[model samples]
Target: MQAAILRDKSGSLKIEEIEIDKPDRNEVLIQTVASGLCHSDLHFIDGSWSDFAMYPMLLGHEAAGVVQAVGEDVVGIEVGDHVITCLSIFCGHCDRCLTGHSYLCSHRQEVSDRPIGKPPRLIDGEGNAVNQFTGLGSFAQEMLVHQNGVVKISPDMPLDRAALIGCGVTTGVGAVFRTAEVKPGSTVAVVGCGGVGISAVQGAHLAGARQIIAVDLESQKLEWATQLGATHTVNPNDGDPVMQVLELTGGGVDYSFECIGMKQTAEQAFGMIRQGGSATIIGMIPIGVNIEVPGTDLFLGAKRLQGSMMGSNNFKVDMPHLCELYLGGRLKLDEMVSRTISLDEINEGFEAMINGEVVRAVIDFGT
Candidate 1:
């Protein structure tokens, strides 16, 4: 199958014919129907993030696909099922997984890759091992992943739209619905207007936030946010976004989300939250970058600064529920897809993401 392969940091993905292994016990082979080009993918492609990325890697995780085959040991999922792939793989027996916090499971690596002596799931035409990013790696025509990463969804859901739920939507919406649990009628603010940020706006809306403030430097994105669910938009170019948010929310918002993943924006999100409100950082701020907040406020005001990973999701439960929301016309997945491109056009998709030209550009592998 033809796949996009990245061999180095800060480099463009080159489309090439690659090799995939057959489904082993506990694995499922999926025919990639649609994969969203996410900012997390851009982070590794552009070298801003590289903690888990392996060279000669297949770098896509947010996707939905049709199951082509499943290993004999894989239970509860079968071939012909439509599913969304999640990177938050877990071992069911881990303390975190046993405690309903599977997203924080420590044994996740065991699910993504086989043991040391086993053959690799992906390889170059020459048979060199190629890492599948987060084990799904949907930038290609096919993927072989553990059942833990696959979430079966209603087949009626559009694969293209369902793809967003794997990551961006899950992270953003999960942050609002699961993590912070923003109260209905409360005021909320989200910084950044990218796909994930816009999804956060939708989440705030679903939570019934009375005032949804969207902040960004781009007017186009701010407009997009408003259409998604933000009751108000703020362009940082106009003035300090923190002050703007404070002014709009009377004193401050009940909750704030930092979706941009920058040190400055993280602090700004912290600054705009009400005295006792929480600020959830959903963006993947670079490793080693520390965000500093007011120390006195931590004690005096009882403010909270928290980090959310992949919206602290339980894929088996969350993905299907999210799909129902989309099918009912409640979740805004249609508007989230700015464009769809073929696998060969993958580089263009990432380029568009870097330029902030699209909300979520999906790769239609069948194309």
Candidate 2:
């Protein structure tokens, strides 16, 4: 199979011919259809949350595709089934899974590269082993993953749209529905207008939030946010987002979401919450970075700050329901995709994301 290999830090991805091992019991092979170029991928490229993301690793995690083959023990899915790839693969027997927090499962990935107890799935022409990013590696033409890493969806749902369900959409909507539980008629603010931020706006709209304030530095993104259902828009370049939101909502909002992973934006999200209100940080801030907040404000105002990972999602349940929401027209999945490119154009897609030119640049692999 042809895969885009992330050779090393600050290097162009080299499209290389690789070999995929056969699926073992509990694993499945998927024909890649669409993959979203997420900011988290950029984090790896730019070296934020460092890990043993082995050299020449296959990149990309947010994806959706068709099931090409299934292992003997795989049940509830079969060949030709449409599916969305979920990075949060969980072992059903884990303590987190049993506790109803499978999204936080400790054993969320395959222990061995081979299915069950086999060999690694990926290797070079010389048989050198390579790593898979987030255990999905949808950047390739095909991927073999644990059955738990994918959720079957309706065939009617477009694979391109379903791709966003894997990460950006799930995280943004999950933050509102599962994390903060935004109530009807509530005032809310989202600090970023990227793929995740825009979805956060749509989630707030679907939740019947009366006043949805979208804040960003880009006019184009704010326009997109308005179309999605933001009742108000603020560009922090003009003035302070906190003050603007307060004036628009008459003293801060009931809930605020920080979709841009920055110290200043995180602080703003925390500081703009109304008394007894909650602020959810949806973006991945750099590790070891610190933001100082007044202790008195937290104590006297009863404000709370919490972090949301992948929208605190239980993928198996949440993803299928998200598909239904998209099918029902309540979710704006299609509008979230600004453009699509081929695998060789992957770098350009990330560049667009960093430049804030697109909500999401999807890699479309047409079979």
* Among all candidates shown, the one with the greatest lDDT: 1
TM-score, per-candidate, Cα-based? 0.98, 0.97
lDDT of each: 0.91, 0.89
Model 1: worst 10 consecutive residues (lDDT sum): 46-55
Tell how far residue 301 is off in model 1, in angstroms. 1.0
Instruction: Give the Cα error of residue 209 in candidate 1, in Å.
Output: 0.5
Model 2, range 1-367, lDDT digits (tens) per residue?
8888887787457778999988888888999999999988888876675565578788898999999999999989899999998888888887888998878888765432454545788997778777888888888999898888889999999999999999999999999999999999999999999999998999999999999999999999999999999999999998998998888988889999999899999999987888988999999988788977788778999888999988989988999999999999999888899999999898888888889999999999977
In angstroms, how far off is 25's CA in candidate 1? 0.7
Model 1 residue-pair collision total: 0
- For all predictions, the C-alpha RMSD in Å is 0.9, 1.5
Query: What is the TM-score (0 to 1) of candidate 1?
Result: 0.98
Residue-level lDDT tens digits of model 1 in 1-367: 9899998885699888989999999999999999999988888998887666788899999999999999999998898999999999889998999999999989988888887899999889888999988878889999999999998999899999999999999999999999999989999999998988999999999989999999989898999999999999999899999899989988899899999899999999999998899999998899999999989989998899999999989979999999999999999998989989998888988888888899999988773
